[model samples]
Target chain A: MSIDDKNVILEIDGLQTYFYSSEGVAKAVDGASFSLSKGKVLGVVGESGCGKSVTAQSVMRLVPSPPGKIVGGRIMFDGKDLTKLSMAEMRHVRGDRISMIFQEPMTSLNPVFTIGDQLSEMFMLHRGMSRKDALDASVEMLARVQIPAPRARAREYPHQLSGGMRQRAMIAMALSCEPEILIADEPTTALDVTVQAQILDLIIKLKEDFGTAVEMITHDLGVIAETADSVVVMYAGRVVEQADTVELFENTLHPYTRGLLDSTPILGRRTAGKFEKLNEIKGMVPSLYSLPKGCKFQERCPKAMPICSEREPQLTEINDSHAVRCWLHIPH
Target chain B: MGPRERPQFTTMASYILRRVLQGLLVLLAVSFVCFCLFRYTGDPVLMLAGKYATQEEREMVRHAYGLDQPTHIQYIKFLGGALKGEFGKSYVSQVDALDTILERFPATFELALVAILISFAVGVGMGIVVSIWPKGCVSRILMSGSLLGISIPTFLTGILLVMLCSVYLEILPAFGRGDTVQLGPWRTGLLTLDGLKHIILPALTLSSYQLAVMMRLTRAGMREVMGEEYIKTAWAKGLSPAKVILKHALRNVLIPVVTIAGLSFGELIAFSIVTETIFQWPGMGNLLLTSIFETDQPIIVTYIMLTSCIILFINILVDLLYAVLNPKIRYN
Candidate 1:
């Protein structure tokens, strides 16, 4: 639990982001805890509604209101408690120290502005660079992202670019300021398989060059396996398991994590002489409003025990750098 | 041949010519409809010669105004006169109809320009404020106030403003364009300080609905844009919320807003009939209303043609603006 020993760039402790609506308070992120080390990629993998994106938005203080809010959390970034900072103060930290890329490249960019204008604005606003210098930097950043004809591309708008190009332009803008930490929320989800791989490779390559830590949020375990140094598996707005990527994949813990790994369609993994159906986690995801009494995954878990239905389990450390939230992992 | 190639001058020239031709076609159709409608509405001779006039006098009056001809022939003549800027004499004034309309054009333009400016400034400003802190009490008040602006009719608002600001308070002039003041050798006519006082009530009245509409569209657009991934990316880049909203959110929102504002400009010019009549302002709207009452065929036809031409021109300007505001758009 003491992830502070490492050169941690971002440490989130017991973060609780909630959505309060007429229906009820839905704990979108209920007591989630994780740490991202410097110059490393940490993948937070989960199902669609598992609060992975919410956790990332909370870090940026970009949660929508009237329904969504970061009710409780301590997001420590570069020795500053983001939750404690005023909006004005937080603005300094956003896009400067901790930048983010988004899921839908097609829509993430401001369609009205040229890519150069959007990218250069980051430098002008935060770095206080002159328009000429900012634009030059933008073109440079575009080139660094491996864009063909970076100068011309910068002058173009988001819609004019291909999907892959737009996402790269987004990356170019995010990385323009050379941020300390980059949070990419499902950055490749809306792209084709080929484009997705290219974007992922680009991210990993850029992370190396910039030495910026990354929090990669995705439902695809394959992406996590490919890009993550460490991994956090979430279920129902809480971290069900957390471990180094290799360890998490090799020795999968938590029924939800196991279910996710099993569901992945790995090449050449079918049983010999028999056609095997894809494994599906049974039962619908519990609605945020009316979750069950005990373990959230208990109803859908094949190995559910009486204790799972009776009480929720804490995220217990099972080994060095490995944690799981399950009665099975709890010491007697 | 590439997407970023600067378009050839010939291409732009051809595009503009095509647009102009299309606009002329639209104007022709509109003129045809207005000619038929006004001709069939009532007897111009009845209004021109009076009900007690002799049959010969009525016939002479009809022939004098060129209204004795068939509708199609009259339309051809009207189109010919409009093309040459010779809109015949007014039925009541005995002055050239084009001259009368030209005299009123500046006043209407001045009022419409100021009103549109006010609407843009207040609407966009309030929209940004409301959208930024959408759940705050201030935002709620502004949104509710905008709804009130939209709900109230312009004439009612005009009367209320006049009552409060002019009649009761004596702060501003009650009606009419104020007395013209000459500075040096040049007379500003309606732009003088005294003239501005007369404008406040009518301008506010003219822009009430537009102001509300701009605010609502901007607010809705901002609210939607704020949820976009690029906005989240903007914050994550360490941009202050103000910068994110202004530089990132506002630019994107302006696309739809500009469309509304541009289209509404035409509406404001045409619909000022009610506001002008209420205030007794010597604008084109007032002239049109009086001309209609007198069954002034030449003035009425010219006014309709002028308004439609202005609307068509504005539509073309809006289309060109799309390319400037959003680089994705291209005329070619």
Candidate 2:
């Protein structure tokens, strides 16, 4: 599906990554396709292991091997195919052209070094600045991310700071270079709700201030609602639906997307309950390896049809910047 | 701490003082055990003179060394004298124990310092490289080699080095702590200085075991840290692998790595016992071993105290480092 003709900074076509494990070949990103434009937060939402994070990692070429391998894909960044870059070339592109903030805050910053050292080191190595220049830039970056007492905190090691502070430091490091694209892979998963909101806001402001495009990978539909301009709903290693955020919420055609939205615990919306519990999809996500022949997610699709079980439903455009891959949504 | 609080300088000084005091108590307890254990083994004169000492002469020697005093009085006197820079006299050397130890200390220091430096630079560097550069033939070979190094005994490894390097290379010394061809008091014990005139073989003998251990522990620590989310995040941010491994991975890996490195230093002291005996190096290890053989109770006791004191000092330093490396750690 063509996602509105904008300045597509990143476009992935039929990206497939498989893992060779004892169990079987796990297709982590099986023929996943999408495009992300500049200054946009394209939220790719999915459950854990549904290939949302893998999609992001693959774009950055961060997927671990043996069990995970990018067997097929074209990651078009600017004019170059990122997948074809040499190891040395990829290293330069990784933090300079593209930056990724990870899920766990505590695990995303080195515990031994002071926050300042990490941030400054980035400047020193990438920007090739003097130590003093690196330090000044680091302090500025820290302040930009709204860290308390940037100078003092810079000298403080990771363990000395609280969880939220570490996440901010991570963002500061990621944004320090002002890469064109910032890939945040569930960056707030480990944070408390309040801190989560603050971090999200910080990211939005940073992106706006720096004019950086964002490919935000997350499992939370609520977070997507607040931040994403567009949303790609992934199921069983494939994009089930893609649309403008408002359109996706207003007219979600895919059964899986419907289930996810329906399941969100909404307060004051249910008749008898204090909070309306989300309706869980009937069955679990299928194993990536040894999946069903045609539709990997057909087993749990509410509107599953015989055609869906035998032939995978391709994502067909239903409206401007909107698409759905479901037999029910298929036009006769 | 308020501005009115103890000046920062005073606080640091007080902290150091407390640490020293703690070291003293530990030294006392350790010295008592060494005194009791060494004395209980057998009389000093019989071991020293080897059935050559007349009864009166043996008594005279014992009296001179203060061995005739009660155990408690000897301990108090020994502890007091040790605190005041007096390590008592070595009956065999017929010189101040401090002087005799000082004479050998340089050689041992040189051997250990070189070995450890080699271990740290090679082991830690290789570990970080292997972790970041995994999935290659060289990385695999390095990792497996590290595992093998850690599993094998240092002496056996030392022997292997001697066989291959000494017997094969025919350049480095295969065995011997150092040669007796001394240049001056400074070069008395070490191979490089006193015997570099004959140094290579013995230095190799001293360092061989450490190479394996250092490589192995560093690999293990770096590998584990590389797996951490922070390291992955650093890599994703487009930081070069070197920066990621050294700054992000190495820093976090170090507490454990340093622990391993420091513990190896302690192990070096013990391992030197065998290496020193094998090579006949005139270091603390050989001296201690010979004193034990001669049943030189006072000197042996003194030797044990010295080793324990070194260990105690190392432990304190490690604790201080913990505070610096990890802010979560509180000395209070």
Q: Compose the digit string of candidate 1's lDDT tens values, residues B1-332.
A: 45425564456667778999999999889878877766776786787788899999998998987888887788898788778987677878889887888778777877887788889889999988887778899989988989889999888899898999988998988689886665564334466778888888889989888888889889889878888867766666666657778888888899878887888888788769998998898889999998777678878978888899889898889877765676555633
TM-score of predicted structure 1: 0.89
DockQ of 1: 0.59
- Choose the strongest candidate by lDDT: 1
TM-score of 2: 0.86
Error of 1 at B262 (Å): 2.5
Candidate 1 off by > 4 Å = A1-4, A71-73, A268-273, B1-19, B33-75, B133-148, B181-190
Q: Give the alpha carbon lDDT tens digit for every residue of B186-284 in model 2.
A: 665443353663445445555655666666666677767777887787777667666776666677677766666676676566447776666666677
Give all TM-scores, in the order shown.
Answer: 0.89, 0.86
Candidate 2 residue-wise lDDT, A62-137, digit = tens: 8886567889979998789988988788878877778989888887787666788888877876799999899999
Candidate 1 yields a Cα-based lDDT of 0.85
- Give the Å error, residue A51, model 2: 1.2
Residue runs of model 2 more than 4 Å from their true location after superposition: A1-6, A270-277, B1-22, B37-94, B125-194, B322-332
Residue B124, model 2, lDDT: 73
Docking class for model 2 is medium
- For residue B302, model 1's alpha carbon misses the true position, in angstroms, by 2.2
